[model samples]
Target: MARQTASQSTLNTDPVEQSPAESQTSQEAKKAPAKKPAAKAPAKRAASKTSSKTAAKPAAKAPAKPAAKAPQMKDEAAKADAVSTAAPAPKPAAEKKSLARRKRPRKAPATGPVTIGRSGFTKLKNISEIRHYLRTSDTPVFFVGATAFNLLGLDRWVRGFSYISYYDSWDGTHPRVFCPKDKPYVEFESGEQINNWLLRNHEVRAHIERRTPPGKRPQVVMVFFDEETERICEELDYELILPSHALRERLDSKIVTTQIADSVGVPSVPNVLTTVKDWDELVKVTNKAKLGQDLVIQTAYGDSGKTTYFVTSEAEFAAIADEVVGVEIKVMKRINNRPIAIEAVNTRHGTVVGPCMTEITGHADLTPYRGGWAGNEMFPTVLDDESRHAAVQLVRKLGDRLGKEGYRGFFEVDVLLDTDTGDVYLGELNPRVSGASAITNVTAGAYADVPLFAFHLLEYSGIDFEIDVDEINARWEELASEDEWSHMVIKHTTNSVERIDAAPRTGRYVLDHFGNLVYSHGDLDWHLLTNESEAFFLRIYPEGEYRWKGADLGILVTKAHLENSHGGLTLHAKYLIDAIRGMYRTTLIEGDEPQPKPAPAKGK
Candidate 1:
């Protein structure tokens, strides 16, 4: 790739130093004044003639005081005046200018967006222009979060792109990622807390400050953040390039998502929203709404399926009664369904949708939670053409509605495809970049044009550009249909919390013809995986971290699907999982330790 030149408007070029001849001449002038006055006696007559001649020689070298001795120079000069009993001559105009220049501090370089005229702005209207803009941009863009997995390969496309992560998946070999030095352990309760900790870390803040251009503010993107994150970024002068935290929090609610979907003509599952205090209240609401006895109950907020409840009988409701009594819940009639996840960006032009893929969720071998998301599969036939079109329309509608609600940037939507009825219904909303982004960015569509995320970046880049959403979406859909990709997020599924003594490296691992998994080579991401025999593993919890149940161990990306038609793990997938799990070596923790509760059984 050709090296891009820095923007002239934002770059600061240092001033050239004085030549040796000039320095020598300035030194001679300064010494001449001190020597001429030294020989004069304490006289009754004023030495006007001698002072005039000394001032004419120009005291240029007077500015060359040693930085370490600057403070004492004024005091020394005062004492010399008291002893000599003769006043020092004033400096000439030219010499005074030189001294003033040396004393002034250098101005900081211009940063942030460059000022562009109407004509210059006209050039940035397409992907090629936008790509060039980013390549030459000196502004630093940071992806701050737990792992760099969401935007791993973005640095290759845009200059000044980097990652500030909590986990060092690359073991310090990857040049772009920055991890802070060790600090006292503080138990974190959420992704938001982890991110907040990183932003407030002294080492992390210093790292960002060093990389940041003198006057430019850093740009930050993360998978999760809250108001506290907003405050930290504000304190550090970082520009958080996403929707406002207040707006995101509102949209993150499952109840709010369902309401928004209804307003946009997008259908959610046949459900009723209400608080159920007991089994009798739940039954009454379901009967009044005509929902059947079998239902899926979901709290407004929770990760994966942890908050999702499968209630068929009084026994199941009693078990989870404590969780749902006061919270607003979405009670829906259970349907035979397949889960699909799609990522989209709500741009100024319109909503840009990426490829739709099947979600791998709740495999006991991979996760302890019954409905926990494991991975995703992208292939030509994941959905039929008609069904695929319907899904796209539904997602675009939701995206447009979200845009109207003052929400923009990247978001993931889960859609349930009813196997019996062939209807697509809104599942839930993740108001940020998701695990699926790894596969989404490497698709053939990204090759033909840019990744879906490129559009998101452009929205935050403060550049005005034009794009036809229909045309782009159509081309992406065609490209995605021909691409085959799949990835599994391997988690520590055991009940015990053990510290990992040794862990596998992050790179390519292949399965030989004899079924033995071997290390192929060290690579950054799974974008280069050529065949199903090989897989790319991004190790998350490296050596020395506690491996508790449901904690992410690593992510395995393969060229083939890992699930069967019935949504069960395939034999090949199981083989890969078992082989990868065997590579980890962990020691059990001593004394009292936290143990995860068993997850609920899978629902039909």
Candidate 2:
């Protein structure tokens, strides 16, 4: 296998950098300064310069000085001096108007449809206006990926919204999904390759062109994209709604996330960022930091389940020495922890957080890798009031800090709840649309208001809007305890490869009296699922496809918790897993037989 390029491997992007157009405006603002009112009062001129500097630096900490103490005659004299200087060099009315225009803030161009043309777009003042704009506008928006799992039902909210995917999960029946017919077998190593292939395909290009108007650039979005993806979008003249790929690569580093969290007062698990050559150095580093004997080691990049190591002794360290030696890693003290997953969107207004969900990981029946994320569970009483509040604050602070770094869109973060201490610490940061988004968008809060993703789209929509983020957060917090939902990503857990002869269909399933899962009927998405008995299964590998260890078979979304009060799989959850796996019939691929093609990468 060839080495993976940075573009193919990167999984994160940021929220704090200014937009390109905003940066250009800031530079132009600095170029022209208002003329000094008076030359006589050098002290006043110095004070004015200080004020300008303060305005330029949003994070400036300098305290403002009190107004100058001057007698009535002195104030009048200064005013007379200013009038004299201005009277001598009075500018033309046209020049005065131009300067005033330049001084005023420049409005950004509309990212969605421009109803007002050069005059600018109508600012969406409230949630009602935002919902109306999205529903009524005909702007072309496409979510390009291998499958529409992360954002499956978003088309119902936004007009002209379509999904351009490589896999026909809906068997070409869904109206909003576009899967090209020219797809040939290709062993893709990453989601980036799958997206690139779809973008370059003739049929996909034609599909996009057919829907797009003349001289308009259709919008393209994906769960995973890179520099190559950006280049393709540029070549094809499509607007990729994401941050710069370079920024993503930088923030993808675990070390960078830790540092940023420290600066913003977001607590992380006690850890040290360093390079270790062998077990001795590893011990020495941990000893100095007072990290316990049990440690969690993580490489700067890669799937955490595959790259992260748990070591308690020299023997354990020696086993993975080849991969960890001389490499920069984050080593932390291991603790009894329960991981929580939450999604948030960092916007110009503020970071709007979603409901917190308990992560289901390391299930032997669901995944072969330990610590591998299998699914997420959300329920009204899953979390106590204290844990939920602390988790929300951590995510909100982290999002605000990232926004300061110029990242202004969607991102997911893992918060580790120390079961022993009840403390919530920042875990891994996934600076992209994550697997948990499916649950995040359908919570009671989302139904009452808008989905958390609506804020992300608003940021990129180029329309000015304002809302009380605190109010939204407060409402979401209250509503989180009023709903129960769960979804699991079921993968092939066996070691050997096999060819699937028959598989479950992509639709709703109900359990029969004999404890079997029966396909109820065809459905577009899981939004309409009514009860826990009915589960929506979205298949990734249909009949005649190959399944290997860790290969995703399908996703099951249903109401109620898949996990129990004791943090174990419930009987119904076990039944659903067994029944679903029983539905697939596969034959083992023995030695000497050709190996099966690899599936496209799924976003975690």
Candidate 3:
């Protein structure tokens, strides 16, 4: 790989320091004035020539203070340093008082998006408005961790932006702030816990003393799933409106999703619903539904194909039954369908769906399950018109229902198109702004909702809004299908349990040899460092006092694939994960402790 010249923001930038010779010259200049007077005092030795010029006045002149004082000052400074460090039991109270009285200058006030670490950016926009907003506002922002970050992208956009949003980068040390300054203090503990604390008591009592005045508090936008964001809002006496929360909860449930799909005239796979208490009844229902010998089960509201399951025997079902107690389970006929999912955005105007995505699956651990997932590829051979219409119908119906429920943001509805049968089924519906929302934001069909999810927050907040959903959807349709966009969130099939290492901080961006940029995450957190095609590390340690471990969460990539090249029943999807994992080095470990790093050579 070619090594490019380091940019100014890179670690290679150097700072200049004064040379020793320059220091000596400066020191000598201070002594010159004192020496001038000391030399004049020599008139006493030459008193016999006193009548010349003004030399007679020198006889009554004072001694040269400047030259005499210079040495004394230097000696005093040296003594002070020695005293401060060397004195173990005794020290002058006056010297200590003088030292403490020199107040330090406040650092440069950063006002804008936050950049991770000590990185500098090329340019920034919205400086004036954001600065005005911050300077005058009394509202406080809390920060949390575990950003929706996969790349260091967030560090670029959010480094100088605002008050902490309750939790910092989902990936690293602290809740990062762009508006005020980079606050590396948020990295301690879990981002989930910080957000939860806010929820539990509208204020972060331990760290801060007061709340942002009610009128000035900013709307909280939820880009990731954490139980506490809502709770904190309620406690603080602030309006915590995540429009997606209400709508997604309704549409997110499998039964609710299937029903909505049917209302919109979309068909689904044959399935039966089961609760925690009714395995036997579920069996009876499946038998009555007449699914087949092959079956698939789904736990409601999960991501990256974790909620999905395939079963062929009593034992397989039994293992899941034990783990997923009290959760709603959806059992369906195992159909030989090619897996395809799409990103959709439902604004106040209407719902706009992105290009089709084909999920990558089939790792050995998931062979028993068969369709185990690795990632998703967009532009997986376009779905036929019939299936496309079905997808539109499903999303539109859900969007309308969401409007009634006060949800107006970016959400993704998963559509499963059966290749063998030419049928469509609503596979999953993520009610909240989903992992695919970023793709939708940049689509030509979509107007720049570059900050799309924020609109959802506005709807639930005290703010009033009206949007032209139809226009947005039409525009979205044009852009969404024209170019293919894809994204995949990486997960560990063999998950660890022990907490090791530190958090992978978010809010930074990276590019490939092809020059494609990868964003940190939907939330600001974590950064992936890659110097070459093969050398990459997802640096996750955030500032502060918390510990992080597990199948170390790392980078996520969204790359375009050839049209219709990704869809398949099982064989095609299997290698994507193994291939992604192979691109970098990560060692699996027992439990939540961080993945073990390789030991360096003994003699090197």
Q: For candidate 3, lDDT tens digit of each residue in 331-364?
A: 7888766656555555544664555655544433
Candidate 2 stretches greater than 4 Å from native: 1-121, 591-604
Ranking by lDDT: 1, 2, 3
lDDT, model 2, position 61: 10
Give candidate 2's total backbone clashes: 11
Query: lDDT of all the models against the reference?
Result: 0.66, 0.65, 0.38
Compared with the true structure, what per-residue lDDT tens digits does model 1 show for residues 7-55?
0000111112223321110000111111111111111111111100000
What's the lDDT for residue 598 in model 3? 36
Which lDDT tens digits does candidate 2 get at residues 157-187? 7665778866566776667777776544453
Clashes of each: 0, 11, 93
Taking all chains together, each candidate's TM-score versus the true structure is: 0.78, 0.78, 0.56
Q: Measured by TM-score, how close is model 2 to the native structure?
A: 0.78
How much RMSD separates candidate 3 from the native structure?
A: 24.5
The local lDDT score (0 to 100) that residue 450 gets in candidate 3 is 29
Give me candidate 1's TM-score against the actual structure.
0.78
